[model samples]
Target chain A: MEKTIGNKTVNVSEDGYLIDLNEWDKDVATAIAQEEGITLADDHWKVIEYLQNQHKNDVPLTIRSVGKSGVVDIKGFYALFPEGPLKKASRISGIPKPVSCI
Target chain B: MTKNIVILGAGTAGTMMSNHLRRALDKDWKITIIDQRTEHHYQPGYLFVPFGVYGPEDIVKPIEKFIPDGVNLKLGAIDKIYPEKDKVVMVSGEEFDYDILIVATGTDIAPEETEGMMGPHWQKDVFDFYTLEGSSALAKKFRDWEGGKLVINIVEMPIKCPVAPLEFAFLANAFFEQKGMRDKVDIVFATPMSGAFTKPKATEKLDYLLNEKNIEIVPDFNVMAVDGEAKTIMDYGGKEVSYDVLVTVPTNKGSDLMERSRIGDELNYIPTDRATLQTKVKENIFAIGDATNIPASKAGSVAHFEGEVLLENVLNYIQGKDLKEGFDGHANCFIETGHGKALLIDFNYTHEPVSGTFPFPGVGPLNLLKESRMNHMGKMAFKWIYWNMLITGRHLPFVTTKMQEAGKNFD
Candidate 1:
């Protein structure tokens, strides 16, 4: 299935993940974590929510501010989502309009 | 029939190659250059545009003005390269046959490749100095701006003129100091690399300069996305850095034609023999400048040196002789550290940047790995050399194609 994040359309495997209560459930989280190589934490959920909401609201995020926010370390975040959130989260969230991430 | 030589993308490498080859080839040999634009930019001047040191009028000139007479300059977008046939097809459906092809089609910024980089805040709070337009726009923004938090970020590696963002940060410090706004602004440098530079010695020097300038160094910070509304840059680690003004060095990639041709590596850079400058896909085709996937610094000096070696090989190829592997991957760059002082570094693939006397060993002139006023003057004087000599295929008096070991302190 595909969903829209920011201006991008991302594909989610039908068997992979499911969104639950503003957070990705265990199965979906595990799939996202394995796929993105990130250890998703509760604070990271806040980041995910913020990114998703920013996409929905058309707000943009800077990498510097993201690093300073202290939700996660810069290296850890890069390891989990090497391609960055707009690409990875959009795919996991099943967002449409993938080019919007650009 | 005269042999046809087609050069794609009339940038630094393309222009230099055309000038070099035109002098070597007889009148009977046809040399055609294909490019999309009529204006040729002195790319290094883009860094100064944001600081008002170089105006738009200074950087651009007509492509025809620089290209020699008798060489056909075709202004059009290249569609694809048919290496199997030794031809380049243009977007306008015109195909030109060539005996040999030179791919000098340099790189482009893919700000769009990064999420939210080209979004609402683009050119407003988030600016890139890599482009002529972006740099000029930033100058205006810098002029009227009361600084809060100015963050200089490099999104990825392999960007053109790797020291440019650092130069911008340094220049920004000088700019703010001149304007008496240095106390008002907090400058931070965020890079994807483990340190300030790719080389360890250069990194040590740059780290010291960063600390000296009070520019906080946040290394290994991989950019995730930009929250323009929130004014924050988030890393995957959930670390966020907030900025009042975001100066970003976006991701750079080779020409889209590489993607269309399906012959490039992961980043769309053509794989080539590092020493030969010959494309791995075809013997008749060669890659130069920022286009090749060579593990060397992508500076104008690298192209200038590569041009020398490649030209020799090209002539050898025409005579049906074995091409010599002469390119040493030599690159020399002037690092501007603000305050009317700069550092010079000369190195190749194997050697890290070292400190010693340059050109003349232990005698006089430019000092390597040390900031000096003379190096800064040399850096400033290079613009005249570039336009009058370098691009015209004239050999620089003090500079050579190969790196000399005599002047460097290896120990």
Candidate 2:
């Protein structure tokens, strides 16, 4: 399924996770953040930036790696993304769902 | 006339009962088991998944492999049950009449029952290690993850494997130490109980372990909500626990089929007579394992013990004899304390886990309420025992279904 996020038409799974990574942009991130009941703060942006950078560099984004990234501490990462930090951060950053998640 | 024995579910209790009944009953009795899925999971192994002790493939096998030749295995969802008529209806519109019915469909983690539990963060930062998929997902999450405040919380009690969360904390401590970053991880154990565990004797030993490991124990915490945005879990009393990553043992409930069949409690667990393992709902119906509302630990060991009691009582009921009120709520648990050491606790309805040796009075190789390498080996050996001896209805030489007080230390 596809939904219009801001000005971009991005593909999403039935569960509302982003399906197409290529279709994601800054506007899409803002839209996802809005849906998740979060306003993108600087700390949130740092996680999204780190996640997008890791995806671009072909690095696997895990909670441990994210904690070790030095961009934010593990607790800070949770505060930034709230409910599911890794999932929401990745979604807002416009990446395909992580393989390890259910 | 052929008498039919219909067993619902093909899990540990159901599978073991099926095997036992097939051997004990004569050829005139036709045995049939109904399950929605074909694969059976070693649920206890799920606790080891996040720590990478066991993989998904190592714990799962075909249900048909354990089932005997004479038993009929039916694959279909349960639609409804008519206890009054001694019949069961499947979702596919198939029906089966039974002279005796045993319900052992078991319980599952219901994450959605908690508010904000299955939100966007689900499978991301907040995860459970109870199910095969959940544990596998957590295994990936734990890999290369520098830890922060790792909160292991139980939403409520009476869950399967009561000792598992404590085991997880111990294993995670070991896991991080192996990664050489044990100092970086702050582990917190938040529970609804007043202490580290339910039984007093076991609680004292476990509390010391937690204190020695520098892991915080937040007891009597009734979780009300998970504020994903704030990254904190709020309790009923307005206390909050923040987490870097949250590992939860969600609320466990009986199979949905139980409620549809009008044979279960509010939680869908069937009402069963404590001693006999027979359903209080009907004379011909019986319930066992995690599916029943018995005051027993919902562990595989308890199920195995119940299987022993059930086999005898079910047979007696079939022959119109007095049912044996022999089940003693026997449960044995192994607490994995990491570093190649573990603890074993054996208890039943009346007794709490105490300090001493197990099975053998003065010559036991296993220690109770104390950490030992022997206990660890015994814990690891149980997987093989479960597949080979326990489910096959083979009697274990040393242990009995009833709790023996000879070896246990009360003073």
lDDT of 1 by residue, B40-72 (tens): 999999999888899988899998888988789
**Per-model lDDT:** 0.81, 0.86
Q: Candidate 2 regions off by >4 Å?
A: A1-102
Each candidate's TM vs. the true structure?
A: 0.81, 0.80
Taking the tens digit of each residue's C-alpha lDDT, what string does model 2 give over B150-251? 999988666888999999999999999988999999999998777788877789989999999888999866576887767789865567999989999887
User: How high is the DockQ of candidate 2?
Assistant: 0.01
**Number of the predicted model whose TM-score against the real structure is largest:** 1
| TM-score, chain B, predicted structure 2 | 0.99
Q: Flag clash pairs in model 2.
A: A64-B145, A64-B146, A82-B228, A84-B121
